[model samples]
Target: MAAPTADSASPADSTDPTNPADPTRPVLDCRGVWKTFGKGRDRTPVLRGIDLAVHEHEVVVLIGASGSGKSTLLRCVNLLERVDDGTIHLDGDDITDPRVNADAVRQRIGIVFQAFNLFPHLTVLDNITLAPRRVHRRARAEAEQAALDLLDRVGLAGKAREYPDRLSGGQQQRAAIVRALVNSPRLMLFDEVTSALDPELVGEVLALVSDLKGDGMTMVIATHEMGFARRVADRVCFLDRGVILEQGRPEQVLDNPAEPRTRQFLQRLLDTEPA
Candidate 1:
């Protein structure tokens, strides 16, 4: 497959030149996003003053130690977690606005988690079809076909009839990804998708993600997979203490980190890698 092109559409243009019929704008745009837990004066801020933009077909990877708010940031993008302040825009519409429909906004953005959230009772095929049929009001046959195609895209078509318990960790995770893709999301949010997998199994999920990158899927991934981030991300963002410490091209941030904290984190990660 050919690599997906960057979003050539301007902010003022409502129609995406890359995907004209898709209503979602710019993939994702956020400004001054903040998430704090607890009451005033005792609140713990998970994300503070985050401003980010992701264009169509771009892959931006968020890298940081646990508790750095990477996952919280992803949740904010999809409105899974409400922001105490700031704004989030998806496909050019303000999702953070009170008038915007949250369910409608979610259709344009799909999220996959570290744990495979597959339904145990349902076959992989059913797992992928449920949302489209129920939420999008798609016909059963149409949804099934879409699910099958997504499963094939994620290399899980052969296991579509199998239950979640019958699959390996990597296979289950891939199924979860297919479920997200079946919704035709313009932007995908991956929150530590490989963190729960066994060491050997991580490659399969990463390979699937790499393939998606090749196909030009717009995505924001929060992960600790340094190699994957370096290879697949168009931009790498380092987050610490609820703020983006640094962000730039992968080569600049991963190989030639400018911040002292980023350097220290990378050093520790590299040191822990097996010889």
Candidate 2:
């Protein structure tokens, strides 16, 4: 995995379509990001001075405790939550700028949350095709064809016609991932995707995500599954109290953490894991 490097350089030219991950830049860049909620003295800082860069095809996994700000960081990247400070760049474009079109930028990002959030009335195919049809103006046949191909890729070809209610929790989550992929996004974000699934069902969703990484997808994932994180991540970031306390290769960070906070955190997680 390519590690993020800090840069004090000015923004690249807009006319230049140079790849952000082309050794000189990262595909997803979050520079000095800070996010907070509430007002005045009651303010709560969720993310503090976060500077992360994800190069093309790199998988960066964030591991932390419940209040560590992992979800908030992902939300900030997708522009679902506005950042209180700093800049977020996607493929060299400053996505956090108020002038940037939010919908247009979202077309290039695929995010899957803990919830499936599939439309109960829609078939799996419809759920997957909704964004392409309504937002991208893709014709019905074209969108359905793409959705079918994605479903097949995830071993859910036969479930395309099935309603969300008819599928198992794992199946529903997989469909949700497919829905996010219908736009063919350049960046994928997963926010504890398997947290809501039964242990037996969690493997299927995690397997699909691992396969996505094999396909060279650049992704930023927040997961409690330490095993899954070790298997998929090129780099691991451990957050503590809204800040990245330690980050390194999975072997170094997950196995032999340099920071005491990280070591204690990983030890607690290990204690909870079944024998």
TM-score of each: 0.89, 0.92
lDDT tens string, model 1, 15-83?
432454655446677767889988979989998888677888989999999999999999888888888
Error of 2 at 259 (Å): 0.4
Ten-residue region with minimum lDDT total, candidate 2: 1-10
Cα lDDT of all candidates, in order?
0.85, 0.87
User: C-alpha displacement of 248 in model 1, angstroms?
Assistant: 0.6
User: By lDDT, who's the top model here?
Assistant: 2
For residue 64, give model 1's deviation from the true position in Å: 0.6
Whole-model alpha-carbon lDDT for candidate 2: 0.87
Output the lDDT of residue 221, model 1.
Answer: 95
Per-residue lDDT of candidate 2, residues 1-275 (tens digit): 12233222223322232354456577887876889999999999998878787878889999999989999999999999999987888888989899999999989999999988889999999899999999999999999999999999998999999999999999999999999988989999999999999999999999999999999999999999999999999989898887777887889889899889999999999888888
In model 1, what is the error at residue 246, expressed in angstroms?
Answer: 0.5
